[model samples]
Target chain A: MAEVKTVQECASMVADGASVMVGGFLGVGAPLQMIDQLVANGTKELTLISVVGSYPGGGFDIGKLTAGKQVKKFIGAHIGTDPALVSGYNTGEIDVEFNPMGTFIERIRAAGAGLGAVVTPVGIGTEVEENASKQSFYGKDYLVFPPLGADFAIIKAKKADHYGNLCYDGTSMNTNTTMATAGKVVIAEVDEIVEVGTLAPNEIGTPGIFVDYIVKGFSTDERKAIFGEIWQKGNKLK
Target chain B: MNSREIIARRIAQEFNDGEVVNLGFGMPTMAANYIPNGINVILQTENGGLRFGGAPKAGEQNPDLGNAGGEPITMLPGGSAFDLAFSFCIIRGGHVDATVLGALEVDQNGNIANWKIPGKFVPGMGGGMDLLVGAKKVVAALAHTDKAGNSKVLKSCTLPLSAAGVVKRIITDKAVFNVSSKGLELIEIAPGLTEADVKAATEADYQVATNVKTMTF
Candidate 1:
């Protein structure tokens, strides 16, 4: 059984200079309260990894951390959404590493699965190949990428059982499922927490064995309003 | 219809029945509204979820059922959601039949430069590289020219490329082009536009197809 911790408690475990993986596409599936708590705690000089750079609009979700200058380095697939991160990157305040989103997630999965490396053809003919090692298989070229793991994984899900098993609401499962396995300390922030056996096995997105702690971040209504606010605030791409 | 809508409508005609397609941001996403009535095009949102329907009404939005760009959508009868890695596998593993994306530039050699610009801030390439390299076909959908009346079909792209020699076709507001070993082949021009008009707006050297037709929306 997994112990349910407060967002503060779990966030406190993330020390300064630690490497953290945040699961989200833009701001979807992000552990909002936990991120806010980390920002509030003034965690600094952190290595942050995310999928879409974070919420398109400024100072929301993981964008807050970037804006707060808590992150010293960012590894992400897209940074165009957040103006602060963009300026920070352009001005050299934050070091940013770019990868195609598929390679980013697959590298994390490789770490958790104990794979040494994965060779992919995605970056073969582009500047994305500049940093990686190259190899050929079956008469084709591919870039070899090692695994990327983090000290902490912070993710958001719709629901969780006492045992830390998680259920993602839908597309919110994006990077959250993979990061759960790659983080040395996996913390899941969910909207609801239920008793064990309340969540069926097949429906479980991330098994309890991979999750180290569960944090109830919001109620269903609260999450709804949060999403509504995101739309109302013009943070959406559409 | 406006040029963007027209471009999207034209791109919609490229899909065959039951083929899985992924749409990129901006103009490429609008193609969803124009898929032919008889065609059942499956949508693959890169974050997760497959074979989904179009967006919901503003008040009907479901946060969990949104695309990679955060637009709300509906899952069809056989639609299913998977985790991040598997969703990418469907993309990187070549299950996607076609991917339509907006290109900043398409060169004479059919390469696309979409993710980055010279000194401007832009989003990083999310799944573009994998989609370009893995999908069976890649379609570049954009306007024929930039806002300043400059041609985007170039002798060579000045910006960074998303991938080299991956775009199979180029659909713009002015024309439809088939990318080939012999460079861009002008196959279809927009209604009210002529072959000479396409040539004047294009910087890349290309040949007109023998059977050139006006694009049908």
Candidate 2:
């Protein structure tokens, strides 16, 4: 059985300058309480990897890390949503590495699946091909992207079994399930923890064998309030 | 109709009944609202939801449900969600029937540049390259000219390419075109406009289709 841990304990596991893969598309399925704990812990010089910069209009979710100057670098697919990230990129405060969304996730999948690299024709004739090495099979050209793994992966899930198997709600399973396999240490944050048998085999979005620790996250009401507050703060509600 | 709505409606006609279409964010997303009646077009967002419903009816938002653009939405009856890898399988594996996206520039050869403007706007190309390459038919929906009144359909795009020679059709407020081996073909012009107007507005070289007609919808 996976030992249940505290948010503070999980936050302390992430060292300064550590590479952390956070699972979320903007704010959806983000480990919000864990992110807040990281900020409150004053962790700095971190490499933040995810799918997008943050929520649109910014100043919430991962955007808070950029605001606190905690993220030294950002590796993801989109940066246009968060003004904090864009401003940091322009001022030379944060280094940004851009990748196509699918390719980005595929590289992470490669890492988790124990593959050496990923080759695809996705970036064939664009500037995305500039950084990757090109290889040819027959007559078609494909770009080779190396696997990307992180020191720790913070994943959010709707429910978890005592053994750390996770069940996701809706589209919340963006990069969480994939990042779970790629991280050296994977910590799952969940709203509720159930007995191992409670989560059916089909309900297990991410298997427990890959998960190291489990932490309790905010309840549905708390998460709802947080989203409302963030959107209001970002003027999406106001 | 306004330019954006007109462009959206025109592009909406490109999708036929029982077709799955991926709608990119911003202007291209507007095409969903204008989809022609009785045409059952399925909308897919690469962030991992498909067949999205209108905004939540109760106005109670669920934190987990949203589209690629980060806008809150609901899945329609028979809608489904999947993991990121599976989502991209539907995207990068040529399962998407058609994909509609806004183009920053469309060159004479049907190439598009929509991801970056270098220092000004550098949103990472999010699933655009895969969509263009994997979709059976790729549609470029945008205004005929830019905000500063420069032609967006140009001789060649100065910006970096999102995907090479992938655009199958171009829909704009002023005209509709089909990309072919010989380059852009003007198939429909806006009502009250003539070939001269399209030629004046477009910087790229094009051929006039013999069956050209005025846009009705």
Candidate 3:
């Protein structure tokens, strides 16, 4: 079972320089309320681990944090989507770490699953090789990446039971499920909160055990408006 | 057809029935429209969709189920949506048959440089490196030359490399070459192009195939 809290209450728990994992590919599965609260609270110098880059529009999704300079370092795949992130990185205002998409998620999973490290051939001879050690097994060299764990994970879900079992809709489940496991404290921002028995066993994407707190998120109409604004600008390719 | 379309058509022919193919963000996404009529290939989007259809017409966008580029897309009958973890599992676990991607530069050694530009706002490598490392065959599709009329096929890439020696084949606006251990082998040229024209346009040293001929669209 999980405690139900306000977005402000959840955001208040985070401290300066804390490492946070944000779930989303762009802004699809990001915790909208929590991110908004974090910005409103004026949190600073935090580290963010996420997938891909920021959302399509400026001051939207992770872009708000990037624009506010709330994030000191960003560890994820892709950063070209946001102009603020680009300028920040180019001017050395913010530190940036790049990871191959698959490796990024796997590293989070490794931390969640209590594994020591992840070994894969994704970056054998590239600059990714510089950060990780190379281990050759069975005549092929593989890069061994250390696991990544966060102090808090902020994620969005379609629905949540009072006990914190989550359900997601469509591809919006991108990084939420994985980040749910990797965070020391997991806060779920959900569109709907139903009774505990409402979510069937198979329908729950993330079980209650992994979730610590839940907050009501944008209503259907509000969410649709937000999605429209962000995705309409997603016309250009990166 | 335009040069990009021509390149896409040629790469589409490489598909086998039921093959699971991953297309990179830009030019490679165009290949989705040209899959051989009779082939039944499953398309995987790293953003969390499998068997997804091509870009949706205007006013048909669905925010919840977009591609890596955040464009609206549809799914085939048996297609399913999963999380990023599972989508990447199919990619990094060596299940994708082929991956088609665009490149900023590709060298004689088949190394590619498409991920980032030095001193530029790096859009971080999204999924190109994992696709190159895991796919059974990697094909790069792009214009043969840059805007300044410089050859994109090179002896060595000056831009930052995406992966070292990962390209298996390259289909450009001008030619198709197979990257082998020896070097690039010129196997097909565009219509109205001469061997001399290819040689002049290409900076990399390539062996002209004995069976070289104009590509049929």
Per-candidate TM-score, chain A: 0.97, 0.95, 0.96
- TM-score against native, each model: 0.96, 0.97, 0.95
Q: Candidate 2 residues A127-196, lDDT tens each?
A: 9888799999889999999999999999999998888899998899999999999999999999999887
Candidate 2 chain B has its poorest 10 consecutive residues by lDDT at B54-63
CAPRI tier of model 1: medium
Tens digits of per-residue lDDT for model 2 on B111-181?
Answer: 99999897788878878888988899999987899888899998899998999999999988899999987
lDDT at residue A45 of model 1 (Cα atoms): 96
| lDDT by residue (tens digit), candidate 1, B1-217 | 7899889899889999989999998888878888889998888989899978765655556667677876566788889888779988999899999999998899889799989875674678888888999899999998899999999999999888999999899999999999989898999999998898999999999989999999886
- Candidate 2 vs candidate 3: the lDDT winner is 2
Please, what's the RMSD in Å of model 3? Answer: 2.1
Q: Each prediction's DockQ? A: 0.60, 0.63, 0.58
Question: Could you give the DockQ of candidate 1?
Answer: 0.60
Model 3, B103-137: lDDT tens digits are 98999898998887777636778898999988999
